[model samples]
Every structure is written in structure tokens, then in C-alpha cells.
Target: MRRALLAITGLAAGTTALVVLKGTPGVTQVAQDRPVAEAPVAPGGSAAPAPTPVRSAAPSAPASAKPSAKAGVSRSPGAKSSTGARSTTAALKATTSAPKPANRTVTGPVVSYKYGSLQVRITLNGTRIVDATALGMPQSGQSGLRSDDVQARYSGTAGEVVAKQSANLNTVSGATYTSDAYRQSLQAAIDRA
Candidate 1:
């Protein structure tokens, strides 16, 4: 019984030592014998597998200097392409410059609603509502109003107003009172702009 226990303990210790040693630093070169999983075909077409880098003794050459044989286009990095010779890697320069828009902020009047008074300042950049900040949110007085929750719910609606470029926004769930107040204040700011 003593000999059997010692042999079992020895085998377990050896196994534990091997597992620890196998995981510690230097043992990564072992090729995985796992079966290659089928790669999904891309919607565009059959996509090429990403190239794996191999350790090499020779000095690496510049990617741009190495011209692709299949594609007739040869691209020169950082420099413009020559006439009659097409480049697949060429970047187009912008033909026209967009004028810089003036930043304007329109403050809305505090709309006294059933819940509380709410006011907002709407910042605009060329008709686009950049930001909407609630100047006066619903106060926690008679009603058990949470400012944070109201702000969080109204935030999504405010973002939609900016994205849609209109005050016509959907009311957030569980925050109808705040949403209504926000809409009126936002519309006022929009009209001011």
C-alpha cells in the first residue's frame, strides 16, 4: 500500500512538473497538428488568406519597389504616378475645399411642464445640431425625479435630433415627461437658430 501511494504521487508530480515546464516561456515552435477549419467565403467573393510571415536570413526589400507581376499598375510610394502608367495605390487629392462653418449656440426658454421646468442650449454647425446641453433639467421637489436617469434617457433622443437634423425625436422609455420637455426646448433652440 505504501509503495503504490508513492508511485502514484511520483506520477502526479511528474505530470504537474511537465505541464508547468511546457507553459513556461520558450516552447512555441511546435507546429499545431489541428485539422484546418473551413474558412467562410466573403460576400464580395473568395477572399485571399492573410499572408503569414516566415523567419528569413536575407534582408527584406521595400514593398513599393517590388512590383506586382499580375497587375499592370506600378505604384511609387509618397510620389505622384507618371502619365500613361496607372497606379492602384494612388490617393486622389481633394478638388474643392469645404467652407468652415460658424459655431452658434441657441439657448431655449425653460418650458414649465407637468414634471418640472426644462431648458436646453443647442449648439449648431452649419444647420447641423452639434450638441444639446440641458441647462435646467427636471428638479427633484414634490416628484421623485432622478436627474441622472432623465439625462441618460434624454441624451439618446438629443443625439438622434442632431443626427436627423430635426427636433422630431422618439421619446426614451420610462422618461416621457423629460422627453416632452426636451423636445419643446430643443424646438425653441432650433427656431432661434
Candidate 2:
């Protein structure tokens, strides 16, 4: 009678343990049976390679079942194969990456000086100034020479406007008024940008 009770108690304990292990959430039966190694899933819900099955030496496993690894994994209609996934990833990366902002031109308001009115136009590659040009400036007599000096010192891709990337600039010698006007117009362009 003691042996019978012991057997029943052991059986109940074993059954309860089996139920607890099997009924646990987030753990599939196959996952419990095998160690699953999964690849990283690509963006856009693309399916990754299914876990490779571990084969046993037992003859009960047939050769026909060797190809069933991938067959067991279900994918969406738009899902790409592992090989096609590479190209899909490349395409996805290309599309997902933001394109550089197009080079834009912004013209500052006309700034007047002692000689004449001057305006500055700037080419911006995003926030950085790529080039600066004198749209309107003093172009006669002494004023023309000073305008030329100011343009040379502060305009173009190599000039202070692109280097400093701001309106702050050193005043060009003998062209203080033109430089100031240029700086003022450049500031306006920067503000607009």
C-alpha cells in the first residue's frame, strides 16, 4: 500500500512538472526541443532565415525532411529571399537614407552705401554657404575698385563668407563701407536661409 501511494505521488509530481514546463508562454515546443539561432531581421518587417534544425544520428529522421527547414517559416507576400534580401536591404538603405538638400540660392536685401546700393546672393548647400556673389554693387570709379576688393575678400567658395559661414568678416582695407554693406547683405541672406 505504501509503494502504491509513493508511485501515485511520483506520477502526479512528474505530470505537474511536465504541464508547467510545456504551458509556459513565449516558449514553443520546437524551441524547447532545439537551440534556435536566428539572423537579424531586416527593416520593413522582412523575414530572416529560419533556425537550422539539429539532426540526430537516429534513423527515424528521413533525408526528405532536410529541405523542410525553410518551408516551416511562413513569410508575407512581399518578403524577399535571403539572397534577394541583400539587394532588398541595399534598396531599402538607399531609400531610407535622407538625400542631401539641393543647393539653393538666396538673395539678400539691397544694402546702400556711400557709393551705391549693393545686394548679396548666396548659394547654400543646406545651412552652410557654398558661394557668395555681389548681385548689385558700386561699379564706377573709386567705388568700383572698392567693390571689387570687397567682392574678392568676402565672396566665392574660397572667400570669408564660405569659410566663416556667417556674416562676421574682417573689413577689407580701403573698402570699409563696401565691406560693411556686404556684411549687412550677407547677414540678411543668412537670416533668410
Candidate 3:
């Protein structure tokens, strides 16, 4: 009974693998005498370019089984055996040809000062600082007025860092503790970058 069950499972697995291979683009071909055009559905929902036909090892299917659409598929003299490898190679080529973006961003470590937590996120265009965002500045324990004050101070100090394109910002006058926290966080992010 166990052997019979195992045999059935193996057969099911084989059938599933076949179904997958049949649908995979450039991986399996049903025709042997002539290259059949098939818009084999790509891994992505979008259809990939027509597969370059490689020689098939499997027996040819009846003409009725092959799709009638011939325009989308064509035969190529040199075809790769593995569709996955070909797609990966294509992706690599595309990435290598394109230039990486000049903008860089880093999130600073959180700095806790005087019952408040502060963090800074900075965006850079090459060596110049483009923007800074303050995060986690509003203390849950503080009143609404105090939270608003902390946010304003950190943002103003962050603006100074952006304008000067440096983390060396002087503390905002009214928000000395928050300003110090911002400075520490900003420096940590810069060091990471």
C-alpha cells in the first residue's frame, strides 16, 4: 500500500512539473519538425519576448495542439537551454548599462535627550545635503504644547543642516535639548553615509 501511494505521488509530481515546463517560455517546446510560436507566459504577469527556439528533446505534438499564432515567435540559430539563466543574464546586462542614481539617503540612530527621543533622516545629492527629516521627536509623555515645540525646533535645526550642506548645525535657541539630540542623530547618519 505504501509503495502504491508513493508511486501515485511521484506521478502527480511529474505531471505538475510537466505542466509548469510546458507553460514556461523558452524552456519547453512541443514541436520538433518546425519551430512553433508560443507566447509562453513569463514569470512576471507580462509576456516576455518570443523565445529564441532551441532544439527540442521531446517528441513533437500534433499540429492541432500547437498555437496558430506565428507572428510572435521565431526561431533563433543560437538558443540557450535554460530560460531562467537567459532572463537573469538579460537583467544583469540591463542593470550594468544603466548609471546608478546620484541621490543617497541615510537614517540616523535615535538619540534620547531630556525625556524626548530624536532621529534624523538625510538625503544627499552627491556630496551635498539635500534635505533632513526629523523623526520620533514628539514625546508621548509631554503635553501637546511641548510636543509642538520639540517638532518645530528639530525641523528648524534640520533646515539649517540642509542649507549649509553640513551636520555642523548650531542649537536652536529655545529648544536647546532637542537641538542637541538632533545634532547627535544627524552626525550619526552622516558617519554612516
Candidate No. with top TM-score: 2
**Per-residue C-alpha lDDT of model 2 across residues 18-119, encoded as one tens digit per residue:** 433343233355654553354344466875444333322233333323333243233323446665464333544567678889999999999988889899
What's the TM-score of each model vs. the native?
A: 0.45, 0.54, 0.42
The alpha-carbon root-mean-square deviation between model 1 and the true structure, to one decimal in Å, is: 19.8
Ranking by lDDT: 2, 3, 1
Once superposed on the true structure, which residue ranges of model 2 sit more than 4 Å away at CA? 1-92
Candidate 1 — which residues are off by over 4 angstroms? 1-98, 139-146, 156-158
| Candidate 1 local lDDT, 23-117, one digit each (tens) | 31221333222223433333568842321222321223322233222222222233344565543223222323467999888898898777767
Query: Which of the two, 1 or 2, has more TM-score?
Result: 2
Q: Rate the local accuracy (lDDT) of all candidates.
A: 0.57, 0.71, 0.60
Please state every model's RMSD to the true fold in angstroms. Answer: 19.8, 16.9, 14.7
- Tell me the lDDT of model 1 at 132: 73
Tens-digit lDDT track of model 3 for 98-153: 56569888999988887568788988877777777788777454433454664554
Top candidate on lDDT is: 2
Clashes of each: 0, 0, 0
RMSD of 2: 16.9
